[model samples]
Target chain A: MNANIPSEVLPILLILIGTIFSLLSAIGLVRLPDVYTRSHAASKSTTLGVLFILVGTFLFFLLEEHYFSIRLFLGIFFVFLTAPVAAHVLVRSAYRSNVALAEESVQDDLKDFIHTDSKKTKDAEVNDTD
Target chain B: MIEIMLICSLIFLTLSIIAIMYRLVKGPSASDRVQALDTLGINIISGVAVFSVLMRSTGFFEVILLIGILSFIGTIAFARYLERGVVIERKHPK
Candidate 1:
């Protein structure tokens, strides 16, 4: 295998970028408040980081003409599909269970549900009284 | 061969882990601790992947699978306990 400057240079660049992004994501994860926000850090950053690393691996192997480069590509594809789905399931479960948000949290779209819920209970009590 | 960048990123990850660990230890609420644990679990998975690359072996693939499975199970258990306050079922029939 011939060692070309361009082929070797690109993957190394990708690896550095990916690693930096992953580090930033982790830092965000550590600094964020509340479960929801933290999940954003863990999910999004980890996904991008893995993609970057996988790309790095893919390029590394491709330049070398190794057969296992395909395996690395497949891994990247599967992870991209699964990571977001898993994150959604976890976050939705948390929401369904009515986990409390930070006190400073604003823009709660679910507030209407809570309001209408209590109103329905009050209406039920009034009807029962009659 | 960006070994220097890779090592730097590993160090950064370690620092993040320390912060997450602090939350896990000092968390006042059950959910917070669960979040920390989940983050830690992901970090471990990534760390193993990095190690596998560094060692130039695919043997760590099993470790990745094991960690993913256990972390998923553990997260579900913790979430259940958070919602229901129990980790195991009772023998009494409904």
Candidate 2:
């Protein structure tokens, strides 16, 4: 196989950008003050990083016209589907468990859910016995 | 030249791993540590992908698959535990 720098250049650039983004995400994970914010860093940046890096890999192998380039594509596909779903599940679970957030967390919408649900359950019991 | 770039990226990834380790060790809460570990798994998956490219082999893809499934399971388990503080089924109240 003949070496082609131009064909590989874009992939290299992509990988470099991905590496930087991933590093930034890791830093954010450390610096973010609460679990909710840290989940933002862990989920969003890392997802983007993996996407860019996988694109890099896909381009690198596809340029070479290798048969196994299919695997990279598959990896990219799986990451895209799973990353955000996992993040959502984790965050919802955290909220359900009443994980404390920083005082600066300007909103408390879930408090309403907790209250409304409890009231619904109590009303159900009253109706059942009446 | 490609090998050198790959090595440099690998080093950056390692540094990210170190930062993640610091977070894991110093995270103020269990939730924080769990999130860090989740990030760690993703990083390791990408690192393996890089190595597979550098070696011109596809064997590492299987490892990526394994890591992906295991990490997903682990995250769910941790989420369940965080939500209820238990990993097993609760006995029915008599």
Candidate 3:
């Protein structure tokens, strides 16, 4: 199946795939109900989208220009490394700062842990006051 | 044929960027805005990549790297500030 298509078509195919995913991510950002869901969209889809686009771009440069671009490789690695961390931080801070979850959310396992932690802190504060 | 595909992808990227910008502007909470901003940064990187292909130049690769680093820092800082009301802390002598 792979033999029939010309070599030049692959990069273009990758780019189109990346573009569609990226657009879906953006649409998700706008359409999702709250910060948590939107963050999910922003992080996962964009990471994959950018990865595809970067790989495609890398191949295009490699094949057409016969140039090996270290920067393209670096960009791909950087995006993969940083995007998830950024999303995690964003969601953590949002949760800590009392950002309301969507009404439709069914369960919150973190609530118990957070409540216990806060209770322990209050106990420590009372001991300090004595 | 490739040029035409590239052009269409570029248009799609632009539309995606616009959608992200809308969320950035109208997000009901700070975290949503920050999330939008982070996504926007990623979109910009893709846009730059597409443009580099369109122009057949390697010059913009550095710009993509720079944006990636800066946006990461920006997101972290904003997250820290949101979490603790401070982005940096100094230890006080006991």
Backbone clash numbers for all candidates listed: 0, 0, 0
Off by over 4 Å in 1: A1-6, A69-78, A96-98, A112-130, B84-92
List runs of model 2 lying over 4 Å from the truth.
A1-3, A115-130, B86-94
lDDT of 2: 0.82
| lDDT accuracy of residue B79 in candidate 3 | 99
**How far out, in Å, is residue B73 in model 3?**
0.5
Query: Candidate 1: global Cα-lDDT?
Result: 0.66
RMSD of every prediction: 5.3, 3.5, 3.1
- Which structure is stronger by lDDT: 1 or 2? 2
Task: Choose the strongest candidate by DockQ.
Answer: 3
TM-score ranking, high to low: 3, 2, 1
* Candidate 3 wrongly placed segments (more than 4 Å): A1-5, A116-130
Residues B1-94 of candidate 1 have per-residue lDDT tens digits of 4456556656766776787788788765666677667667666655665555555566665665566667667777766665545778675536
What is each model's TM-score for chain A?
0.77, 0.83, 0.86
Tens-place lDDT digits, model 3, residues B1-94: 6788999999999999999999989999998898999999999999999899888999999999999999999999999999878898755424
Model 1: colliding residue pairs:
none
lDDT of 1 at A76: 63
- Span of 10 residues, lowest total lDDT, candidate 1 chain B: B45-54
Pick the TM-score winner.
3
